[model samples]
Target: EDQVTQSPEALRLQEGESSSLNCSYTVSGLRGLFWYRQDPGKGPEFLFTLYSAGEEKEKERLKATLTKKESFLHITAPKPEDSATYLCAVRGSYNTDKLIFGTGTRLQVFP
Candidate 1:
């Protein structure tokens, strides 16, 4: 059973508070790990794609790293605009193009 789960369903942080979000996954023959940031009522914006363990990708205030069984999204000095739903997806070798998504962790950065 391939699955993805995100922790801390919702997070509220002050403007500069930094934190890490977790994405735990269980998949057979892992293909890729994807991170996306989504705003309310819109599609997810692509963040990173991790292909193997020890892979790390970054953009602006967010950094994502991957391992065999889990992935982490670390936010550094987040801002109000950085607030959104962070999603994790895993692609299996048997499943192409489609990514199985976690429910997502909603983050709110209050100024």
Candidate 2:
């Protein structure tokens, strides 16, 4: 079965701390994998989309990368404003219209 799993269900970090969030998946064929940042009481905000292994995307303090079976979201010197739940979703070739999403890693950055 195709599935996505994220580790460290929650993360607490001091301002300017750096860390990496993991997203692993097992699918028949990968079409695209996505990253999103969602704040409380709001919809997810798109971050990146990686289509194949070795692909990467970056925006400000966030960098996302993809491998053959997993993806990673790296936070660099995060600020309090970066606190949010980081979500990972995938689109498999078997079901192009559907997306499988992980439970997400809730990140809290404190000063």
Candidate 3:
């Protein structure tokens, strides 16, 4: 079985603030890890794909890093426009394409 857990269910930040969100996970057979950002009512937008330990990816104000048992989403200089729910998902080697998703971390940035 594979599982993902995100900390700080919600976060509030003033404009220009930077913070990091944690994602802890466990999987039977390691495969791949993914990160996404979703708006209030929209589907998750792809952020990154981590296939090996020590792998890292970034986009704009966000950076994602992966390890054997966990991942991290680092947000830098966040603005109100950056507010959204960040999600993490992982696929195990045994699974087809189905991914186990995390509940998500809701981030609110205020100006």
Candidate 1 vs candidate 3: which has greater TM-score? 1
The Cα RMSD of model 1 versus the native structure comes to 1.0
In angstroms, the error of model 1 at 58 is 0.8
Q: Check candidate 1 and list the clashing pairs.
A: none
Residue-wise lDDT of candidate 1 within 1-111, one digit each (tens)? 779999989999999999999999998888899999999999999889999899899898999998888999999999999989999999955857778899999999999
Worst 10 residues of 2 by lDDT: 90-99
Candidate 2 residues lying further than 4 Å off, grouped into runs, are: none
Please, what are the lDDT tens digits per residue for candidate 2 over residues 1-111? 779999879999999989999999988878889899999999999989999899999999999999998999999999999999999998865846799999999999999
Q: List residue ranges in candidate 3 displaced over 4 A.
A: 93-95
Off by over 4 Å in 1: 93-95
TM-score of 2: 0.96
What RMSD value applies to candidate 3? Answer: 1.0
Which candidate do you rate higher for TM-score, 2 or 3? 2
CA shift at 67, candidate 1, in angstroms? Answer: 1.2
- Tens-digit per-residue lDDT, 1-111, candidate 3: 678999889999999989999998898776889898999989899989998889999889999998888999999999898899999999965848889999999999999
lDDT over C-alpha atoms for residue 70 of model 1: 94
Q: What local lDDT does model 3 show for residue 90?
A: 90
Q: Per-residue error at 10 for model 2, in Å?
A: 0.3
